[model samples]
Target: MKSLTLDQLKALAQQTSSPSISIFLPTHRAGQDTQQDPIRFKNLLRDAEKQLLGSGMGPREASTLLQPAQALLDDPGFWNHQQDGLAVFMAVDDFHYHQLPFSVEELLIISQAYYVKPVLPLFTNNGHYYILALSQDEVRLFEGTRYAVGQIDLPEKTPVSMEAALRLDDKQKQLQVHTGTSQSGAGHGMFHGQGPGEEENKVLIEQYLNLVDTGLKEIFREQQAPLVLAGVDYLLPIYHKVSEYANIMKEGITGSPEHLRPEELQEQAWPIVESYFQQETKNAVEQYQQFVSTEQATDKVGKIVAAAFNGRVDKLLLSVDAQVWGNFNPETEKVTQNADRQSKQSNLALLDFAAMKTLQNGGAVYTLPQDEMPTDSPVAAVFRY
Candidate 1:
């Protein structure tokens, strides 16, 4: 799975191509559902082909354009390993796809440009967080959204266990066989570590954590999502001390994570991340309400859209599930709301336009539920002025 970034979103927004093919479908990571993934993808590809042909494209041209996506269906390796959702976009000169950790409704939209609204959730404040579960005997990382969690394969440099980290070649050589009798009176034996002292073990664990943090930095470059640590109490602080990520939460799940499943860890970590997002949105909403009477805030979609384009918007609050289909005239600085999509070339996703512009201009965007939007209107903004 490829990591989706804000830069890629900006580039997708700026792309100009006719008859762009966008396909999104839910995929399964395991079970019988895995067998159904390829079938779903093939169905979407067929629909995209029909849409392309209906848009006055030649059958051969449609086939040629969709070839890359079709090939994914036949590749056994691609279908065997899956995420929650797959988004594919194809143009005359550009073809790209990303396997995302969030689930998406199955849909195919062939339009003037790619339909990227589905991918917006990744950038929204309600997106994903990473859970790093560290233990002396085990280390694992999981990418989690509110709905699902998927474990990421660690790099080779990431030590999997204490013995691995200490470079102990033979398990038997490092173990001290205990033949003493148990308190229950039954004869028992155990394997105890014959290597490193307590202080030396701490040093080795710290070095392992440092390596993990280094690898994570590369994965989290330009990422805005918060990171939650889930491990035993002692290990958490050491990781915090070694981690370079600024978004690591001060609060963490305190317990031995060696035995917990990824799903179990996600269940515990989501609340911390959820609380953080709730607080952020609540503060932003309060600020917008307080500034409603001032020049800094407005609920009018036209004004917000214009402000977003001009880089005057400091923050934008809108409903992610709502789309105000319309067109904006850049020359006249006018916005017209359309009752229906008239043409692919003329009609535009106005909310998407505003969101993209706000993001590109270094403004913060909060996506809330429709009823929870800061204003009665679909869009609202706090201005830089």
Candidate 2:
């Protein structure tokens, strides 16, 4: 899982919508008794009520929030139905701000559960040039209609001389190159000014361009990949002029020669790719937010989870650093925390739950690193109805 930067999170936050309900469940322990003690159950409920009230919920709202447990409370058969359980539920917007129930622990858990993941970027071999892809999370070496083939390195740091040339294949794909020679002025003017300098320079450039054209023709016989001119900035224009006569795509040429090794260039190009994808991702998120905010999209975690259980989820979003520690029944697609245990696994991390639920429903899960999560609403999600 790739970690996301803070900038990514801010972008995502601008797109997330608030959920309808947020439930917080504490851990519980099942005793060895076959029968649940009535007194003990009542006391547990009372304790839960006190905690909810302290969080600002009125008695009525808190009671209504916990109404789901009423079935178990009234029916002795339901009391001991599960091994042992202790949890709390909260409905967002149902209670006023002053009547809301929230704890520092809950806040911390939620924060950790909502981190996002970052995407890798693509770059060119030449340090001077780069391209960005459309996929926000995925990056390719080519951008627009241009694609990269392979790069080469010269034995010497500087070429004795530089030249340009062009070539055309049967398929009409144009190829060009700016070649360098070890001999100074061998093709043009030099100290000697005697050798077939101009002719030799012309030949070298023509041969290089021919070789490039042949390779491209064989690789993409029926189709044409855009041409790229890379070497020295001075030679690019020369190559362009030579290839101008061919049916070459004007957009294929790189503006300048690369100054760094392939590896270094790739590193530098990543930022450009990221920027491109960021814009696209932002646009999609904005659209999603608008739809969700209008109530056309269901944004609640619980509802999403329930929908996922029914195998209706399309996409799942979560933070990579998010940890879920809890007891989950895969068969029922239900989740509950192990509040009674101190171990991390029993704690039921919210992000983990979202991932698990998403997977169970055959939905794709995307976990973003903390920095990559949305700034406004970092909560993980299952996108469906």
Candidate 3:
């Protein structure tokens, strides 16, 4: 499955096509739920076919368009490695899919443009995050959202253990190579002892952590997602000193991460990351309220859509369940609101359009439910200027 990135969203936003098929469904990672994945996909495919046919495509042409999605239904292996949600997009010469960490409601929308609203949350600043679980015995990285988590492979240069990191010279060999943990109930690894042994071990551990942090920086350079460091209490502070990632949270899961599964790590780390997002959204809402009567912010759908397209919006608060069916003319900078979302109309979700444009221009986006929206209107925005 493709990892959905900002570039992918930009590409989709720029795409103008007809009879685009967008399908989203909740997927299972394991157990009996896996058995139901194929069946559910078949139903979505049939829905797409019906929509395609309703748009005046012949039966054979509609079948041809859906052929790629149908191939995935019979693939048993793909379902086994899934995350929490699956999104599929099909159009004229374009097909893309993403395995996301949050579950999405089953939705199918065939329209003039691809219905990307279902996956828009993933493109937002607070959608997902990284968990860097560090330990001398094992080092792991996890990519997670509130609903699902998955491990990411570390760089080859990362040290496997403390011994692997420090190569002692012949003079340092005078220090004893003790293996108390290897033969006993303690964790298996080599330990070195010397005068002021704790200080010496801290030095070596710092060096090892630096390597891990360097590797992590390479991976997270382009990401604004928060990184939570999970390890024993003692190890966390030292790693923080060496970590270069600016978004690392002050609070982390305190324990050995070696025994904790990826989902378990996610369970521990999500709250800390989520609190940050919650506070950010709250601050944005307060900012909008403070400037409610000013030109710096607005909740008018037409004005918000125009500002978003012009890169004048600094933040957007969109309702996930609300859709203002409309179309925009870039040449005229005019937006037309439709009375309803009917098939074959030049209609797209204005809420989605504002969110996408805000994100594409490096602005923040917060998607709330209809009840939780910042404004009584369908959308709200904070302008850049």
Model 2, span 112-184: residue lDDT tens: 1222211111111111122211111111222221122113221122122222122233222222232344344
Per-residue lDDT over 1-385 for candidate 3, one digit per residue giving the tens place of the 0 to 100 score: 3456667777787778777778898998889998998898899899888877776789999888899899898788898988788888888878888887678899888876777777876656565788888777678887777777766666667766655666656544444423233233333334565544656766777888888887666567556678898876667888889887888899988766788888789888988999898888888888888887999999998899999999999888887777888888888889888744653354677778788788778888887877987678878889989
Q: Looking at candidate 2, what is the lDDT of residue 338?
A: 49
TM-score: which is higher, 1 or 2?
1
Instruction: Locate the minimum summed-lDDT window of 10 residues in model 1.
Output: 182-191
Enumerate residue pairs that collide in model 3: none
Q: Please, what are the lDDT tens digits per residue for candidate 1 over residues 105-152?
A: 998877656777777766666656788887767788877778878776
Q: In the order shown, what is each candidate's alpha-carbon RMSD?
A: 5.2, 21.8, 4.5
Off by over 4 Å in 1: 153-200, 328-334, 339-342
List the candidate numbers ranked by lDDT, top first: 3, 1, 2
TM-score (all chains, Cα) for each model: 0.82, 0.31, 0.83
The order of the candidates by TM-score, greatest first, is 3, 1, 2
In order of listing, the candidates' clash counts read 0, 23, 0
**TM-score of model 2 (CA atoms):** 0.31
**lDDT (CA) for every model shown?**
0.78, 0.36, 0.78
Give the poorly placed runs of model 2, Cα more than 4 Å off: 1-263, 293-299, 305-317, 337-378, 382-385
